[model samples]
Target: MAANKAKRPLPSAQPMRHNPNPQQILRPQYGLRISPAGSQPQRSRLHARETAQLMPVKAHVYRTIAELNGGFEKVIQDLQTLRQISFFRNDRVTAMHDLICRVRAQANRDFTMTLHGRELANAGHFDGLCIEWEKQIEDRSDT
Candidate 1:
């Protein structure tokens, strides 16, 4: 039979005060602790089918992207990457490839939108000029 005992009386219990400035606490307590239980909240017990896929985007990478695009493009870019990775549910490397594709897709879409918009503006100007030219021809024929 296995036996277990409290190691050291579990320390004297102290009444927890409402920490006014939680930031002042030496070790900030969180709603969830990041321990060996894995960095995520315990969900329905992991069956063989459910695998842990913890992908944390790093701060430096965030900073780098913010610098590149003045922060305007980071969130959507990251979300697109997340969606791409989600496609390869069981394969990590393939998911990473999907991440690259998402980024490339974002870049391609950005450029395509810019070109499409410029083309539309130019088309509008050309269309207006064509109308103006037709009116000028009618006026000249009347003269």
Candidate 2:
């Protein structure tokens, strides 16, 4: 014969405390504290400055010289447009110009490293064009 076991009673659940000011709840996951009603939260000047700067659009590496040339043309047009806009800062414009120069340099470097003999010789014209484009971008950024 098996002996019977006695069960213990479950403990009662405690009620959650209600918060009077719901807006002041701490949210650790978001890394932002909700300010109390009527008072504004302080923001850093760096954050405001960054928000004003124009972010560059994503660009892909072009495999062909034609594509690279087209990309450069598009960037130049964009820089020109940015200059005309009253809101864009000059430093931001210079940063964009520097980005374009870097892209051109990378393309040229890749072409030189990947090709040799006749292929390299054939791209001599393109090398000269790249130099001219770099000069143009620098001149535009300076003004």
Candidate 3:
């Protein structure tokens, strides 16, 4: 019975597969970093600050220019640009309107100043003419 027993083959061992290219190995490279889960992502704070600083001007600068230069044309152009930005909303539009009002006020002040200047010039010219007429009359009466 021992001589008749069948021999069994042992299980074959298989070799582990690995990448042959060294570059395929996962390792930290220059300018690259791994962040832990729930940690803040790497970002440029200066760039963010600059973008934050620019957004307000990009959003509102045209209206400010219009106010200082006294024109709704600039405000209209600003609205056109503002419409293209997804983030600008009703608040910005309302601010633009307020700026338009301010521009109108500035224009009114400029017009008033011009009118007053012209009126003063006319009054001065009239006074000069009166003085000349009085001098001519005094000379005629003395002769």
Candidate 4:
């Protein structure tokens, strides 16, 4: 029994089959390198304080009719672009309508000021543009 046992090979003694070229071999040549901590630049407190102290600026207020009319042209272009994008269409349209109403109010105020003897350059042009924008808003609302 001792002689037979000695001739028998152990199960764990089988040779391992290795590929000549492994597909997922770890190549140490392409490994990442760790940089020294002293190589990084330091941030200054002055820059941080400067950024923190900055105040939020408000939107430009249109004082004259011509300026408001020019702004209206830009708003029309923006509204056209917004309409092309279908996502959140109703909300954007409502916001644009509100903006148009605010512009019309400003135009009315300018007209009132003109009645009080204040001269406004390009008042006729501005009035025409306001009328055109009102018609556009009406057309859009009808749909």
Candidate 5:
């Protein structure tokens, strides 16, 4: 009876699991290449093609931001001029209020555009524009 119960072979040991390296997916021509040493995260990893692609984007973003900021400045100056005019005359309150409303609307639009620009690549330097706009409107009671 003992001999009939035949010995069973032991199970083989499990194999070790393999760890796979992360796969790098490159864009058609706009992705940055990783540096071998990885010393600087921002300055070192930029590829030549990606840098060229970013130049035009950076220029356009800066130009747009500058123009919008200039427009805001002009509108604020105009409002200031209007305030000075109203100081000498009480009859222009209604007109001044209407002009203020218009200027406020334009400023709102500029703020929205600045936010949209932030979504674009390399256009994150919009804080200056936002701060300038806010500073101009800070003293005004109409805003």
Candidate 6:
């Protein structure tokens, strides 16, 4: 005999709960391959030396240039602040102070790089010409 206890209902299993894989919502080309999506991706097993060899040194130089540019901005900020509360003995001294401040303030640019950046600037123009020529010949049959 039960001692005034209310019995809890057992959860009913749905048909879908037993199915191992869910349905693919998208078509083949638009979505991931089934096995790969369900499994862990293959990882590179490179050592530290190998990884460094594979890394782009140019990209690191670019990043360092960016960091240096940021540091230049902080220095410029300090120089500007110093100018606002500067003391000078003579007109020449004050003029020197102003010149120093101006140079420091001018140093804050978006980036500094080993590259002149001229080739990079012309790169887009070259790409555009290439694309235009390709389009012109894209529809033509080979001779």
Residue 123 alpha-carbon offset, candidate 1, angstroms: 0.5
- Residue 52, candidate 6: Cα error in Å is 26
**Which regions in candidate 5 have their CA more than 4 angstroms from the true location?**
1-58, 87-143
Looking at model 1, the pairs that clash are: none
Provide backbone clash counts, one per model: 0, 0, 0, 0, 0, 0
**Candidate 3 Cα outliers beyond 4 Å, as residue runs:** 1-90
- What TM value does model 1 have? 0.35
- Candidate 2: tens digits of C-alpha lDDT, residues 1-143: 25434333223223357765654544332234457878766445644443344232222222345465666766776787787778989788978978887888887777546554334444554565578799999999999
Q: Is candidate 5 or candidate 6 better by lDDT?
A: 5
| Per-model TM-score versus the true fold | 0.35, 0.35, 0.33, 0.29, 0.27, 0.29
Error of 6 at 89 (Å): 6.5
Q: Return the clash pairs for model 5, or none.
A: none
- The digit string of per-residue lDDT tens for model 6 on 60-82 reads 55555555556555555555555
lDDT of 5 by residue, 1-143 (tens): 13333233323333346764445332233344455575532333445534533322334444555565566555565655666674555446547656766876787688557655544534433444467678889868466
Maximum-lDDT candidate = 2
For model 6, where is the 10-residue window of minimal lDDT? 6-15
Using TM-score as the measure, the top candidate is 1
lDDT, candidates in the order shown:
0.51, 0.58, 0.56, 0.54, 0.52, 0.48
lDDT of 3 at 79: 73
- Model 6 scores a C-alpha lDDT of 0.48
Writing each residue's lDDT as its tens digit, candidate 3 over 1-143 gives 13423333223223346656665344333333457878754535644443333312132333443344544555666676676678878677768877777777787688557656665665665666689799999999999
TM-score of 4: 0.29
Task: At residue 53, give the lDDT of candidate 4.
Answer: 40
